[model samples]
Target: MKTLQASRAPRLFPLRLSFRFPLAALAVMGVLFFSPAHAERLKELASIQGVRDNPLIGYGLMVGLDGTGDQTMQTPFTTQSLNNMLQQLGITIPQGVNMQLKNVAAVMVTATLPSFARPGQNIDVTVSSMGNAKSLRGGTLLMTPLKGIDGATYAVAQGNMVVGGAGASANGSKVQVNQLSSGRIPAGALVERTVEAAVGAEGTFAIELNRSDFGTTQRAVDAINRQFGAGTAEAIDARAIRVRAPEPQQRVGFLARLEDLEVTPTQASARVVVNARTGSVVMNQAVRVKDCAIAHGSLSVVINTEPVVSQPGAFSGGSTVAAQTSQISVNQGGGAIQMVRGGASLSDVVKGLNALGANPQDLVSILQAMKTAGALSAELEII
Candidate 1:
């Protein structure tokens, strides 16, 4: 009996050891198969070519204001529009009788009709005064037919205006905040028509990237093909990729899964943007700098003028005259040459620029000079 027990214990130990080895190998493989930290979903990097929003605009009238409407005398179009609306309502105004309206203003209503919108969906609208009106506050937009670029009515807008501005005036003094001529109405328009969106009509569709890059386009195509199957996607150019889609009945579901797949995009190119008017400088993370030297200084010129009087000497019948004397001075500040070390990373570049102790305005000039001398690897753009 003792020998049988010993033989069974030895067999159990080998079995346990075999199980442990397989488990440890699985954990290591799982870590290596995971996606990278910078991977992003395909939806954020690209969109379907034919799916987009359409802009709709219409001319409308806003009423119910507190003496802040357009003056009919200056804006004759306002009076004409009012008269036309009145005629449509079966109300007749006497000829040669001018209507002095103070509670109505002419406005332009605008809204965006999103893709896949039905006939009854609601959208926000913006009303802007087209005349010289004091404000559009406390006013309500009338029924306006919003039209698309093709001259077709797509939606109807009518709602109370919500102006996020205020102003008061008394004794010829006034103060105001924000804008008073434009206001927004939340969900003020109802879609009356639909814009046809033809996607995958030919058994295929296209993906358009927000920014053009050959490397990103190729990677995206590869990832899509790997997920679906070989020959599923093909690169058309740096900005577009064509993919074979399933039948119409299964197209939506297939796109839903396709957009969720993750892929790593190529790194952005190095670039720098400078605002010339505001003296603002912005640099991206990919920007790098080569070894260079910079010297910055300022030059100023000042002028002074004084009035001089000359009197007749000992009443010699000479008239007194007034003259002017002017003085000018030029000043040049001392500028010392500074050394900048070559940088491979964004942090190193920033530290080297900061070491010069120059203001943003001066830094703009220095960067321009560096670009000209071939010391800056990034493109310099002034806005």
Candidate 2:
């Protein structure tokens, strides 16, 4: 397979939480700012066509599972596989000998042979037990051929599993963290074949932008045409741009130069994404708010229990019974609605939200209401 070779991009730290004291946390809770230039770049949003790695997967067997393998009676494949393996090793078992296995497990192995991977090059592979095996913590993968979608074998994986987790039990109960039934074997797979990639064979080539945006696509085309000529680059669609390569003789050299030319893409569309489960609110830099009024207050509904005992008429073999009664009350706390005007900056919006001092989950519902009222200038997407 093709082993893609490219310089690693610089690490980007997401603007999440910053260490601060309690008071400072409240002070900066709603204030937002974007002083960093090119927080996200156009190149980051795009990708080159035919420059992606392929996913190759195959089924294999794991041996030596410390008696934690699947029950042979249920997973018959384990017994059949073991018998076949033994026969291949010149150890034929009697036809009447019913075999039960406790150390063999069927597993699936997966690996990604990066573009331009050469023959005999080792790559890491993930071996995941697929049978009812309790754990693949200490097992060995047999020679398994990883194949591409075209059904062509590209790599061979075989190695002792390197499970980075451990678990033990005294009784029948089990407790595991992370994963013990799946392990990774670093550099355990050897590339047996290479995928042919023609970056610039005859001459012409194409660049595929990861995101489909007409404005971004047009800008990319313009950038390339400026470097070459008007007819050199053309936008095929919102995602793909075709560029006529240099003469066939200078194809490779031409591509090498083109990749380094930087072009700034258009600004992304305004959008806001909301996570329903976590109550997380994420908004793009372009997101804004219109004039609106908001008043958010917590409504606490509490139920308290008071246990009481009831006694039957004394004597006559009567027993006393205990019962619990619950008392409920609702506390609604709200104030006059605050008027928020349009063209309000993100910082202003943050200030208004922080004033409410609502919990994270409550803040989500408030934002949803604001979005539905057309006061939120960006698209609201809840996930």
Candidate 3:
């Protein structure tokens, strides 16, 4: 009986061990597989320094309006521009002949000439009324030369305006939706020139970070060097990284691969942004707060007025007197002091603030006070 009991005890021990091993293995695997993901591609963090869009602007006239165009008398420039355009078209208006046109509005045409844009490529343009035009709906923009800051024509814009608003006015009352003075023309400008992007000249180029950070720059350099080889990339500063490229023909493929490499950026600084006009409060994950006491309350004033009339007796030969009686009252709400525990994380900080039972507008003031008192461990920015 002793031998049988010992053998049965060993069997029971093995069964219990086997059952617990699988659960322990599963817990380790779950941790490895379900950890928080934080890796982001290089392209999201930086951009090629020289590759950017250029702004182009032009002045032109919009015709075919439904009597909502600029008043020529009020905007003399509109009349002068019309005369010059007519003269160029060989339709000479007699001198001193005032032409009252109600369908022409002067406008400013604007567009962005993208990088690597070649000749004959179309781009969208925005047309804005520069005069007292009631609406720019249903107007045709004339051929206008869009020029860059260098005073060189880069594109020509001409198309029908597509206004997204509707407005009607009658009997001195006006009802409008959205905007009437500005409209967009889809694919209205033809690119006549190309802006050269000097990237990777002399077998090297620069990657500029959107925000300047030394840790992020060092991490990017290290990631690039590890992927390509030692001494392949180096940090110029906190915001720029210089990288060596392969041959000119292979540069594009190399850059495509480089942009895909994943990098984990350093944790950002704690910051709290408050929009005073909108009563908005936003904070980053790194925000924290020290143990503090806060007391918040609201004060309101009420004014009530009533008209009182005093009439003399009938046939007393006295005029009635009119008077106003006003009663003003002030009320202050109770605010109990609350003790807030020190917060080590963003969630804890939020909980501590929520305990004060303050609205967003009130929170703005509270955050400002906490920052002044050195209780809030974050940069407070009011916009």
Winner by TM-score: 3
**Which residue ranges in model 2 land beyond 4 Å of their true spot?**
1-31, 36-45, 172-177, 313-318
Tens-digit lDDT track of model 2 for 112-157: 9998799989999999887899889788899999999999999999
- The TM-score of predicted model 3 comes to 0.88
Per-residue CA lDDT of model 1 for 1-383, tens digit only, reads 45644453211111111222222222122322223339889999999989999999999899999999999999999999998999999999999999888999999999999999999999999999999899999999999999999999999999998999999999999999999999999999999999989999988899999989999999999999999999999999999999998999999999999999897898778788888987777776667789876765678899999999999898598999999999999998836566787876665666667666566777788889999999999999899
Which wins on TM-score, candidate 1 or candidate 2?
A: 1
Residue 69 CA error for candidate 1 (Å)?
0.6
Worst 10 residues of 1 by lDDT: 9-18
How much is the lDDT of residue 283 in candidate 1? 70
Question: What are the per-residue Cα lDDT tens digits for candidate 3 across 243-308?
Answer: 986888888899899999888888788788888897777777677799777777888999999999
TM-score for candidate 1:
0.85
Q: What Cα-based lDDT does every candidate model obtain?
A: 0.85, 0.76, 0.85
Please give each candidate's TM-score.
0.85, 0.84, 0.88
Tell me the lDDT of candidate 3.
0.85
Clashes of each: 0, 14, 0
